[model samples]
Target chain A: MPIVQFTPFSSLVQPAFWHALTDLKIDVLRLSDEAIPVHGSYSAGRSVKDRESGAEIALGCNLSVGGESFSKEDKAPAHSVSATGVFKNYNTIEEFKAADKTALFAQVSDEIWKSITVDRSTAQLSRFLLITFADLKKYKYYYWFAFPAFAAKPAWEIQGDWKGASDEFSDTFLSAIESAQLASPRAFFLVRPKAGSDEPELAPVEEYDTFFANVNPVERTIAFLDPSAAPGNPGWPLRNLLTYLAALHPATSHRVLCWRDAERPAGAPFKSRFGVVSQGAGTGEAASTEKPAAVGWEKNVQGKLGPRVADLAPMMDPTRLADQAV
Target chain B: MHAIQQQYWAVRDYLSPVLKESKFKEHGRITPEEFVAAGDFLAYKFPVWSWEKGDASKARDYLPADKQYLVTRGVPCLRRATALAYTDADEDAERLLSFGDLSATGNEADEWVETHAGRAASTLDSAANAGNIDEIPDVDESSADDVADQVGRMHIQGGVGSLGEIPDMDEIPDMEEEGLEAGDDEATAAPKAAAPSSGVIEASEVEVAKGNLLQVRTYDVMITYDKYYQTPRIWLIGYDENRTPLMPAQIFQDVSADHAFKTVTIEAFPHSTSLQAASVHPCKHASVMKKVIERMNQGVLEEQRKAFGAGAVSPSTGKDKQKKWLFRRTSGPGKDAPALPAGEDDVEGMRVDFYLVVFLKFIASIVPTIEVDSTTAF
Candidate 1:
C-alpha cells in the first residue's frame, strides 16, 4: 500500500480559491520615465450650464490622449491653439481637463476620446491567484499565461504578480477573485516572470498598441477556458492522449505512476503503478502475477495524495474538465 | 381469566414478599398481577421439554401478550441487591452489630443461656440428674447472676461471641439468676424489642397513554435505598408500567431510615398492536438487570412453581423468546408485513445493522454534553 499523505485540504484548497494566479505568468510592465512630448493637454470634461445661454456646455477641456509633440505644422490657421506653455501643466488627462477652453466642443471631444481608449495594459486579468512568499520559496513552481488547451480567444495573457514593481495595485486581483463570478476554478493560469541576463529595456512614453500579437507561441502551454482572449474560443481543445486515457475502462490495469522529487529515484515507478514490480531480491510480491485492478484510486508509494493518479486522468481531458467544472 | 388471575395472585402474593424485596422492584412498580405474569410468561417461553425444538422463532411465539407487557414495565431497578435484601432497621442493626461481631458473641451467649435455662427447666428431670457421678452442679442464683452480669456487660461493649456484645441487647440489663429466684424482678425486664417493618406499597393513579398501536405513560415512585438495592426493585418498577398500580394510596415504606427516598420516573410505552412489546430502560444497567432477573426467574422456575407457581414466571422471558423466534422463522409478524423476504439458501441471514442504524440515527439527538463541574474554585 502506498502511503498517501496530503497537506490539509483546507489550507491548500482555500488558498487556491484566492491564488489561482499562483500558477499563471503575468507581467505588469510600467511605462519608462523618458520624456515624450504631446501636442494637446489631457483632460476630464463634464457638461455644465453656459453662463449666457443657460444651455448645457461641455467646458474646461484640453487634449484627451497624452504623447510626445510632433514637428509644428508650417501653415497655421488664423486662430490656432498653442499648448507649448501648458505642456508641463497638461501632461495628464486630468490636467488638460482642468484647463479653460474657448469652446464647449473641446471638452466634449476630450470626453469622447477618453471613453474610447481603454488602458489595455492595466486591464484586469480575468482571474488571478496570489501566492505567499513562503510558497514562492518552497515550491520553485512557475506560472505562465497561455491557452494551451484552446487556440481561439485566450483567457489570460500574463501571470505572476501583476502589480508594477512598486506594488501600486496589489489589491486589484485579490478583490477580483473574491467578487468575480467564475465558472470553473481552473479558468486562470499563473506563472512566474523569467529573469534574464540583460538589463531591462526601457521605452519612452508613447501610445501603446495591442501587444498580444507580439506574444510568443512558446508561452501558450496551459489552456485557459475563457474565450475572450484571442485565438482561444468556446473552450479548450482536448489532448488525444488524455482522451485515450479517458476511453479506457475505469478499472484499467495499466499503471502510469507519477513521482515526486524527480531527483533521487526511489521505488519502481511504473511497477508501483502497475502493481507488478516488487521491491528487492524476490522479497515482495510481483505486480504482474497479481493481476491488480486499475491504480486510479490507489495510494501513492509513500502513499498520501488523494484520488489516485489514474482517477485524475479522466479529469485531465479537456471535455471532462469542462463538464466537471463547478 | 379469573383462574389465570387467581394463579397469578397466588404466585404474586407468595413471591410478592420476595419480589418486593428484589433490587428490581425498589420503586415498587412490580404489581402482583405483573409479577405473576412475568412468571407465567417465562414458563411458556422456555418450556421444560421444548429444548430440542428450541429456536429463536419458537421462543418469540411462546409468550402470552399480557405477561410481556408487565415484565417490560419493570425495567430499571435499584442499584444493588443487598439494598432490597435487608430492611433499614435490620440493615442498620446488622451494620452496627457487624462492627461489634454480635452474631458470633451473641450466639455463643444465647446458646449458653438457652442451655442454662434448659437445665433450670429440667431440674425437675430428677433421678437422672441426682445420680452420683452426675451430681448436680451448685445452683447458686448469685453465681448465675455473675454469668448473666458478664453477658450483659459484653453486650454493652459490643464485643463478639458474647450475649453482651449486641448493641441494644445490653439495654435489657439482667433478670436471669437472682431475679428468677426472687420472682419479683420487674425492674430489669427486657424492653419490648420492635420487629423490622415490611414495605407497604401505596396506590397511585396509573396513567396509560395510547398512541396508534401503543399506549405509554410515565410512572413516578419514590425509591427508598436504606436496605439494599437489587433486581426486585427494578422488576417491580417494570411491573408498574404495564398495569394499574397494586397499591396507590401510600407509596413510601420505611424499609430503613438509612435509605434516603429518591423518586424514580420511567416511561413505559407499550404497543397494544405489537403482540411483542418492547421497553426502553433509562440505562444499560437497568436493561442488564431486567435480563438477569429474567434469567434468574427462568432458572428457579421449577422450584418457583413449588414455592410460588406460574406467577413466578418472568413476563418478558416468554415474549423475548417468541419475538426472537417469530422474527427468525417467518421474517417476523404478519405474513403481509413488509419484510426482506428470505431466500431458501440464505442461511447466513439477511444482514442489516438495524440496531446500529437506529443508534446512529438518534445518536445526534441525545449527544451527551461533557458536564465539567465549574463550581469548584479551580
Candidate 2:
C-alpha cells in the first residue's frame, strides 16, 4: 500500500528480452515498485475443485496468528500476507511455525524489527497461507522472491528516473515467463552480489551472483557467494529452501539459470565470462582468467549469462548500466 | 467350479495376470501366480475395481479367450427407478442420464460429485442416431465351440451405451427417431435403467448373496471430468455374467424413473453411454481410448476374416515390426498397440502412461473412489 520509486534491474541490459515479450500482451513484472494486493482468507481442506479454482480469492479468517487467546468468533482483519521479519527461518516461515509455535516466534521482541513487521502491523499477525498473488488463468506461472522491508524510504536525491527502470525490468521478466509458458510453475531464487556483500546490503558496483545455476551443489568446497558481505554463505549452503521443497516431492521439477567461467567470443576484444560483457583487452588476444575492471565502453553489454552459451545471449546483457556510452 | 462363486473366482484368477488394464499389463515376465499376487497387492493399495466374471460357457462367445471377466471402475451401481419414469412424450421430456454420486458424506469430493450428478438431463435423444452402430454378438459357447463363433465376439467400438452395436440394425442413424415414436417411451428414454418400476433397486440398499460378502454398498456415479483429458469420461470395464454388455444400465443407472414425465431442453449433443456422452473429450488421453478401440477393431477385422475358415493369410498383411509383434501376441492382451501407420509417427509417441505407481494414483483420483493411497497424493 505504500508508494515507492524503483529502477528496473537498476537499468540493465536484460530489458531487451522483455521488449520482445510485449507483443504477447503479458504483464511486465516489476514487483519492487508495482502495487500488489496481499490480503487472502483462511479456508482449510476445501474441495479440490474449489481449492484449485478459487485459490486466488481471499479466504475467510479462521483464527489469528497471535496466541490461541482469540475468541472463536473473532475473524477481524481477515486478509493475510507473508513478510520477511524475525520469524522466517530457512527463508520460509512455515519451517519456523511448523517446528513449534511457542518454542519459536515467542522469543522475538526487537523494537526496530517490530516496526517493519508487515504481518503484525497489517494483518495483526502472520497467517500461514502467505497471501498468494496469482493469476493462473492469465499468467500460467508463479515466481516467489523476498523484498526488503524498509522502515523509511531512502532520500530521493540519489534516485534516478525510477519509472524507466521499473517498466524495463517488468517487461523483461514478463517476457521470460510468457516465453516459457510454464504450467503450474512455482519458482524461488535469491539475488545477491556475486563478489561483494549479502543481498540485503548489496552495493550497485557489486555484480549479482547467479550461483544456483552456475556452481554445482555437490562440491565439497564452496565459494563465498558474497565475499565482501558479512553473513551470506561462502559456498552453496549444505541446504536451502528450494532444495527442501524439491526433496519434499521429487515428482515435480525445477528449471534454474546459473553462472560459470568461460572463454570470450572469437572476435571480442576483451576476455570475459562466456556471456557477461566486459571491457576489451587492448591487445585483442585471448583474455585472462580474472575479470578485467570496467573501461566505460560506449556499446551495450552483451554475452552469455550462464555456464555455457545460451539461446538468449544477445538479450541477456544489462545495457547502459556500466557508464554513459556517449 | 460348479457353483457360481467358484466359477467367478476361477475366471478372475485367469484374467488377473492378463487383464487388459489401461495402465498395468501382466506380461510374460510374471507367472500367472505372480500376476495374481501382484494384482492382489494392487487391490490392497487401492479399492479393487468391481469385478465378477461372466457365465463360464459364454466367455468363449465374446472373445477367443479361454475366460472372460467383467470389471467396473469401482462397484457397479444400479440407478433408482424413480429418476427414469418419465411421465410424458414431448421434445421437452427429460432424457435423464447418469446414476447418483456415491462419495462419502461431507467429504471434500462431494462438491464435485454434486456437479457431476447434475448432468442427468442430456441433449442426446433417448436413442442416439448412431449411423454406424456395431452390434456385439453374444458368445454362445466355449473357446472350443468353434473358430467361426469368434467372428461374432463383441467389444465396444466407443465409450458406453454405444460400446458395441447389434449388426442387424443397418439404419442406426435413424434409430433415434424410431425409438422416439415408440409406444412405450421408458425403454427408449433410458434403455439401461428402463426396467419396469417395482419401487425397488435403490443404491446401497439391495442385499445380494445374503450379506456374507463385501457387497457393503457398491456405490458409483456415471461420469466425471479429468484435467488431462478435459472431457467428461467414465472409466469402467462393463459387462455381465451372461456375456451380456451392460452399457444401457451404466448409462441410465442414475436416471430417475420420473424423468420420462419432465420436459427437457437439449443443451449438449449425444454421447453413447457416458454422462459426457455428448462429445469426445479433446485431450490426448481421451484420444488414447479411441486409439485403443481402433486397434481392437483390427482384431474384429481379423476375426471377420478368419470367419471364412479358409485359414489363408490376408494379402494385405503389414510388414511393420509393431504389426508383426502384434500378430504374434494377438492371442493374448497387449497386442492392441500396433505401431502407428508409417506417416502417423510424426507426432509425439503416445506410449502407455501407466507403468509406474503414479498412473495407478491418477486412475484412483479420476474414478473418485472411496479410498485412495493417501501417501502418494502429495
Candidate 3:
C-alpha cells in the first residue's frame, strides 16, 4: 500500500552504434541535421541486491542501442522488447546545447499520448528520444537520452504487497506466459485465465478489447516486461501503460504482472512479481480531457540534468593511433 | 620453450611434409583440412559463434566462401584486467617471464609486433582523462534560461488524435515539464538506498562494488585462420564503457599484462581492411597449438586406457610416435588399434574437431577478462 516508483532507463549505446553513426554522418548526412529514426531494445532488469543490507537496489533498466539501430530493424535479442526512437543529430555543440530540450520532450510525449488515446496502440509507450552533437573532428560526442513517460494524476498506488509470479501463479500459467513472450516479444500484453482451467491466455496489447471481452474488470490482468530489478518498484514503461489502461477503463483497480525473466545461464527461473494497482477516482475524465505532464530525461554520470560527453579520439582518430604506436 | 627452439620448430613446421593423419596427435600444427574440420565442430557446438565470410573483396580463396573466419560479437568484457587482483607469484607472471625470451628472437616471418616501450602508462592516463566529461565546458547559462522561459509559456495544446499538424515551435510546449529534476533525484537516491549500513560488508557487496552497473566495456572477438602460420589467430576490437571504440592502450589494459605488448599487436584484420584490431601474434601459435594437441592426445589416451584396458588399445610404439611427430595425418598401417566405445567416439572426435575450443581456452589465459568463450564442459 505504498506509492510505487518506477525505475528509469539507463542508456547503453554500443560502440558499433556510434561507429555506424559516424559512417552515416560522413557518407549520408554531410551537413544536414536530420532527425533519424532508430531502434533500441530493453529486457528484464538484472536484480542487484546489496550484500550488506540485503535490500534490493533499483538499478536503471538498460535501453541498449547497437549498430543495427540505424536500420530501424526489430532485431531485438530474445526476451527483449524493441522500440523505435528518434535520433536528433545536431551539426554543432552550440546548436545541441541551445536546442529546446523541454519542447522536444513535449513533442515526443504528445506523439506517445496520441498513440495511446487516438491510435489505440500501446506499442508507442516505449518510444524514446535521443539528441546528440557528434564532434566528428575531435571524435567527441555530446548526447542526452530521454524515455518519456506521462505522469499519472493522483499517482498510481500499489493496492497490496507484491508476490512472486511463481508463488502466486501455477507453473503451467507462468510457462504459458513465457511461451507467448518468446513467440512474439512485446513490451505490454494482456493476460486472462482460461475459462475452465487455471492456465492463462496471453494476447498482445493491441487486442486488449477482444482479449478481455466478457471478462469482469477485476479479472483483467495487464502485464509488461518489467525492467526494474528492485523489489517494490516497476519499470518506467509501465507508467504510460497504466495511463493508457486508465484512459480505457478509468478509476478501475487492475491486477498488474511485472513479467521478469532471466534469459542467462539457461533455465534460470522467472523472478516476476504480481500485484494490484488502482487509479484514483475521476482519473478517467482527467485522462481524456487533459494530457498529463511528461517527464523522463536521464541524468548524466554526475547525476546532473545535462548531456554526457564521450571523447572517442583515442579510438576513432587514426592519427591518435599512430601517435600511440610510436 | 627457448626462443631459438620455438623459432626452429616454427620454421620446421612450414618446411615439414603436410600432415596426412587425421588424429592430429603428433604436433599442434594442423593442416587447412583439419582447421576446417575444427571450425565446423566449433560452429556446431557453440551457435553463438559462427563462421563469417567477412568482406567479399577481402575473402581468401583457400577457405570456404562462407567460412573464412569465426566471429562472436558483443561479448561483454564486464571489468578490466587491472580490476582483478594479480600477484607476482601468480601463474600469469611466470608465463610472462618464461615467454619474455621470445621478445628477443622476433618472428618477422608472419607476425607483426608493436613495442609499447614506455608509453603504456601515459597513454592510458590520457585515455582515462578523455573519458572524463567534467573537463567539457558547460552549456551557456543564457541560452538555457531562454529555453526555460519558453518552456514556462508552452502548454499542451494539441487536441486528441491531432498528430498530423506540425504545430508551430511556439505552440508546442517543451515536454520535460514536471519530472526532470525529480528524475535526477530518484536516480541518485536509488544507489544511496542500497549502500551498506555496517562497515563490515559481505563478499557479494565487494564484488558488486567492483563494477558499477552503469559502466561496462564490450569486445567483439574474431578468430581468423593464419594461412601462413597454419594456426588460428585471434583479433580483438574493444569498446569503452560508453561504447566508444577503445584506443590501443585502453585495450591493452584489458589484455593480460603477460601478453599485452609481448604478443598482442595492432594490425589490419585479414577480413576487413578499414578496421585495425589488436591481434595476438600467430608467430608462436603453431608451437602453442602443437603443445596443446600433444597434451590433449595424452589425456585422451589416458582416458581411453581407463575405459578400455591398457592392452586392449595397443600402446603407441616409438616408430608410431616418430611417424606422428613427422607426418601426423599419415596413419601407421601396422599399428591398428581396437575400435573406441560408444561415448568414447565423442572424445576421439574432440581430438581434432575441438581444436578451436581448446584454442579459445588458451586464448582465455591471454585475455582473461573478455568472456567470449561460453562453452563449458568442453
**Would you estimate the TM-scores of all the predictions?**
0.13, 0.20, 0.68
CA deviation > 4 Å runs, candidate 2: A1-103, A107-187, A190-326, B1-378
User: What's the C-alpha lDDT at position A17 in model 3?
Assistant: 68
Give DockQ per model, in order. Answer: 0.00, 0.01, 0.08
- Candidate 1 chain A minimal-lDDT segment of 10 residues: A269-278
Native-to-model Cα distance after best TM-score fit, residue B154 in candidate 2, in Å? 34
lDDT of each: 0.20, 0.22, 0.62
> How many clashing pairs in candidate 1?
123
Name the regions of candidate 3 deviating beyond 4 angstroms. Answer: A47-60, A72-74, A77-79, A160-163, A193-200, A214-220, A249-251, A280-282, B1-79, B83-191, B195-247, B266-290, B297-347, B351-357, B373-378
**Per-residue CA lDDT of candidate 1, range A223-295, in tens?**
1112110111111111211122122211111121111111111121110000111112222233212211111
Better of 2 and 3 by lDDT: 3
Q: Relative to the unseen true structure, what is the C-alpha lDDT of residue A202 in candidate 1, on a scale of 0 to 100?
A: 17
| Worst window of 10 by summed lDDT in candidate 2 chain A | A226-235
Q: Give one digit per residue, the lDDT tens place, for model 3 in B15-54.
A: 7554445535555666677788788866654544767766
Worst lDDT run of 10 residues, candidate 2 chain B, spans B258-267
Q: Write candidate 2's Cα lDDT for B40-105 as tens digits.
A: 333322322222222233343323232122122223322222222232343253222211111211
Choose 1 or 2, whichever is better by TM-score. 2
Candidate 1 stretches with Cα past 4 Å from truth are: A1-326, B1-67, B70-249, B254-263, B266-378
Query: What is the C-alpha lDDT profile of model 3 across A1-326, one tens digit per residue?
Result: 55567777778776556777888899998888877788998877654333223334333467888666887446775457898898899897668867888888888999998998889898789899999888778767777898888777777777776677776788778888876776677788888898889889888878877888788777788899987666566788888888888776554687889987633223345678888887655554546757887777876654556676666665556665544331
- Per-residue CA lDDT of model 1 for B95-199, tens digit only, reads 110111112111211110000010111111111111111111222332545544432332111123332211222221221112111232121111111211211
